[model samples]
Target: MAVTATLTSTERQIGIAISAGLAILGLAMAAVAKTGPMALHGGMALVLGIALVFYLGGALYDHPEPTNRRHAEYYDAPTRFGIVMTLIWAVAGMGVGVWLAALMYWPEATPAVPWTSYGRLRPVHTSGVIFGFGGNALIATSFYVLQRTSRTRLADAVSPWFVLIGFNLFCLWAATGYVMGQTQSKEYAEPEWYADLWLVLVWVTYFVVYIRTLARRAEPHIYVANWYYMAFILVVAMLHIVNNLALPVTWGAGESFTIWSGVQDAMIQWWYGHNAVAFFLTAGFLGMLYYFLPVRAQRPIWSYRLSILSFWGIVFFYMWAGSHHLHYTALPYWVQTLGMTFSVMLLVPSWASAGNAIATLNGAWDKVRDDATLRFMFVAAVFYGLSTFEGSFLAIRPINSLSHFTDWTVGHVHSGTLGWVAMIVFGAIYSLVPKLWGRDDMAWPKAVEWHFWLAIAGTLIYVVSLWNAGITQGLMWRAYDEGGALSYSFIESVEAMLPYYAARTLGGGLFLAGAFLCTVNCRATMRAAGDRVDEADRPLATQPAE
Candidate 1:
């Protein structure tokens, strides 16, 4: 029989009643739909919040009273679920990303329909990476990191599954809503309020689970990486809630409008925007760096103090850097200047992190040649270093003037996304899958080698074409004849980009093809492992009689 212990009658009763109550609330709200999108969204949030309360109540009751083995098993189900989902979604999310990149080069590639347009696909791409890709990594890694760092299992399995499965379902809703032309149009907070509220409930439970697990920790000193991870999760939840304040169209229906308008909206959006990068992309990944670098290289972190300093520095400076996105716009000039200055200041902490990762690998150069996983991460750190420096440069007012709305911005984002974020995800997945599956044999080892080279080539071709195209477009837009008339028509710039666009399409195609191979290899590896480790990978039931 299966070891199903986490779920009790009282919990189930509570969950049912709660779901009914939320259903009633949602119907009542939808009945009064004329109130406006914001009101509708608020009403929907109320429903989701209530349903989550029900689930939590049940989860609490169903959880087994602690036994030594039971306590250790508390974390296994959720962690394994999250690990599996991360591997699966990493491929799915990246596939969407590859599609989105190609569309940039071929505007006509996406049909002119509302759902298929650039606006919608752009959010789909962003949501997939940030939420589908990055979000799952955080979930899977945090569970693993927390267990190892705290020297304890998760607080409870039931709630953790709710958090992982629940969060991914929310990602599904948001991505589909976008492709279906449902959105709130806020940068990084594009999910309509209804969707956003679902995330909030899932995340709060995530926080609770994390804290409860910490309470059970065997270790006295919390690992530094966990500190960074916790802050990222907590802060991003706050940022997501505050910045996504909105009006909704209906409950269970995804539609909403952000509260902020004009300059204020721009400020709020980017404030959340930059920090999403700071905390979500950078900080969480830093935790990965700490664990993987040390574990892979067989060395301690370079300096604990440097990690602390960099963490606080990035947090303090980055919140103010979003206004740099609004430079030369209606956002207050002083705010823009502050953002620019802070962006420069932000570089120190960012580099401090980069320096730490690179330094951790200092004496392990020989290891880099044979280990593909370490190679991916080592190169990712180098790209992270380069991208941060480039970010600070572009945040400058003059540079922003040249780069804004051009392909240069596109190139920059891909450098960080494909070059940094995706590389780390690749490494983390490689690290997680084997251990979780307990298989010595990877389905196809050489396929991994081929996949890595293909990704590198794709990323290079994709970014370089955009860079060349961006500079050309930026220059052409500014040029004028001596007669004070236009030197080139808008169509002229479009015509000039055809060759570069074709090159970009080819690059993105290669990336997509490689992702397909990865998915196949992963599936085959799972099949090869079969049931042997599925049982072993779980928590043990009893101690041996000694």
Candidate 2:
């Protein structure tokens, strides 16, 4: 029989208190929310509150006595839960993304539905993939990496679970609120003041858990991966608070107004936006790459000094590069110039990290060839270099003049997200799933190879088609007739994008399919683990053990 893990006395007490507090707060919110989206969210909060109460109560009653067992040397439960959440959100996010791509070409596909419209669903897709999928992966892997590197278990069990659960709750609120047309109108920071506040609580707890665990490290020196993870955590918290400084219209409502106005607001928004790409997307994943790639490749990082230089370089340069998004806008010319300069300089550190990963795999060419998982990491590093280079070029004033507000920018983002970010995440997932489940390999290792090819093909088609369409649109916008009038009408560009949009939809579908395959493979691996455990527990001779 499988073992049932009951809550400890500390966990039971904390859970009961938190559940009670949430239930009270939910009732208060519901009482105030007379109608609309706020009412819906209040109802949700109330349900969650009640559910948690019963959940904790059951645990308390069923297991009155706390077990005197100690935690393992490394805590893996939260990481396991996080990995499951990551897979789920990946499918949901990418599925929405594919639907959005389809709507671009077939606008009437879901007509007369506000919730399903592109505008609302766009944030859903972006936040779902970025925060839901990528965020979970980072949190999960960071937990796993931190413990193994530090040679210590997570410091506080309750805090880690709280952070993960609370973070997901925030993601749920953000996504469902978007569908309900509730937003503060910031790009990546769209979740209203209430959601933002919840995230702050969760994030602070996450930071505490991380630092506390690090402080108890058995290793004398903190590993390099921890530095990157620290940067990701600290910088993201900083960016989130500054950019999301807003005043809610009322305690019962979802509307809010940002504190910064005009150019200042735009600057802050992109500052938050671009760095969301930096710290949230890039830095955390780099931590994964540094640790997992080296271990998988069975080699040390090529240059510790280079990695240190790149870490600081990325930290300094990325903060200023957000201004590049305001290049031709009302922002000051000097600010734009500074953004461009920092962006160009950023290529150095970006490439350094990418090169470091590739160099680490120099002597592990056989491993890369043999293991599809390692190949995913190799491809991810290449895409990281390529995307960073593309980002630098796009940041230049002249280039931004052409690529700004175009599908080229979209392609550029996917190049990083689908190519670099998602690929590394896949590699890490494949690397982790078997080990976490106590299996020697994936239940179906060949499926990983299929997923890899599908991913590559989908990414290439999506990016290349958009690149062509963007260039075509940009050139046509600038073309002049013999009379010096605009040659191509705006509709012409719209018509031009139809084929590419169809192509993009197909590509997105393929990627989503690959994600589904991963889900199947992972689930099978878990089942296999359970089967193994059952067999191990079975009696061979129908006799009791002495």
Candidate 3:
């Protein structure tokens, strides 16, 4: 549906003004930079702004104004748009991932170009999947959960669009800027100063939208899902601003130097990095799992107190655990041990949340067996427990010694992201798509089953191969032949990784295929929406006197 059709004339005008302002800003940036990555980035923004301006303006005079009844129903256009963007990024991001994996074994396939180089594209894949795919899913679902749980429509429709579209623009800038080599060299916070600044603006608007809606809620208490989503939003802003503190070389240029240097910078980077995993990847999706798993399984959470315990535990313990990544570095020994301690402690809450989710499915196994959507969530809970255990284990000084630089770390990350994060997202999408589109099931119900297996097979193959590759790399490097010297050369270690890399490539390819199928299935379902409306799916606002 065209979002413009749902907006009031005032809201449309507001959208138009914002779009025009963005267009002017983009033009100024493009004109000032004149050439280079900054200019290209500005040009892209200019196009986006102009396109939105025309999009809103064209509908301004033609569309009928929405009725007051809209307040009695949830605002979901932004959610729909966000879902579509999520799928698009899933394909784009994971596609790049698979290609990168292939390039590991077939190095000759890399295009001899700056943009296609592994260094640049690596962030593209990460940002695309993490920020692009995962971020969009979180935003979309948060809106859905927030409104339903609070028993209110969104505070204002326009701001939700602003947050969703503006956030996507930030994702676009980050991915494109990486390819153009505009970065502060910070992991997960790589976009230069301007992009960071833009995100701060977008994020604050998001925070406001969330808070404003909550303030207007009909429900007396905020839901558990909202708590996790709020934590995701607030903590990420803190992490991003702190780790990305930098001085721009010039206002108009994309170049910037970080204020932090040396070991302090390393500490700051991983502090932001691992917590990005905590809040962004874990907390937000846990919110998703909390809401959707129960709804899909037709059961209440196993323990309300346990859910509370897990939430607080994750928030407290995860902050300390990031330092574990700095183990064996110039970071102080006490700090490293402290990080290790917190990481091990983290398992209690992580498993608590995961176990709570799994236990909730008791007596609902029949539904889980028959429903692929619920199964996605079930597997996600299992993997969440496994990967979190692995994370805590890897944090130990001894285990970190073997796992630190190798693909073992890589495997651990994907197990969380692919196995835990993506699985939960797909489950939410499957459960949501039908309801959102007023359908009883996906356009092709069988496709969901196909996707589940492909995803499972892909995750196993990719993670297992990397686990083997990482162990071999670590063991070979640590091996001794009684000569008090290394037994294997680095080249030999690289050679041994060839087969594993190929397997990882295959695994990634399969996952990408499943994601593509999902995108296509959603498109079909949305097209079939027609006049089928789920009357029960609405807000609880009483009608005002006409």
Which predicted model would earn the best lDDT? 3
Candidate 2 structure quality by residue, lDDT tens digits, 363-447: 8899999999999999999999999999999999999988988899999999999999999999999998998787779999999
Q: What are the per-residue Cα lDDT tens digits for candidate 3 across 1-546?
A: 678888988899999999988888888889988997778878888998899999999999878888888887888888999999999999999999999999999999999998999999999999999999999999999999999988888888788888988899899999988898777888888898888988998999999989988888888988898999999999999999999889888877999899999989998898899999999999999999999999998899999889998999999999988889898889999999999999999999999999999999999999999999999999999999999999999999999999889999999999999999999999999998888888889999999999999999999999999999999999999998887888999999999999999999999999999999999999999989855687776777534211
| Model 2 residue pairs with clashes | none
- Give one digit per residue, the lDDT tens place, for model 1 in 236-318: 99789879988764443456667788889888889899889888888888888778777877888888899989988987888
* TM-score list, all predictions: 0.86, 0.95, 0.98
- After superposing candidate 2 on the true structure, give the runs of residues whose Cα lies further than 4 Å from its correct spot: 1-6, 61-69, 530-546
Winner on TM-score between 1 and 3 is: 3
For each of the candidates, the C-alpha root-mean-square deviation to the true structure, in angstroms, is 5.0, 5.0, 1.5
- Kindly report which residue pairs in candidate 3 clash with one another: none
Off by over 4 Å in 1: 1-68, 109-114, 249-255, 530-546
Off by over 4 Å in 3: 542-546
Return the lDDT, model 1, position 516: 69
Could you give the candidate ranking by TM-score, starting with the highest? Answer: 3, 2, 1
Relative to the true structure, candidate 1 reaches a TM of 0.86
Better structure of 1 and 2 per TM-score: 2
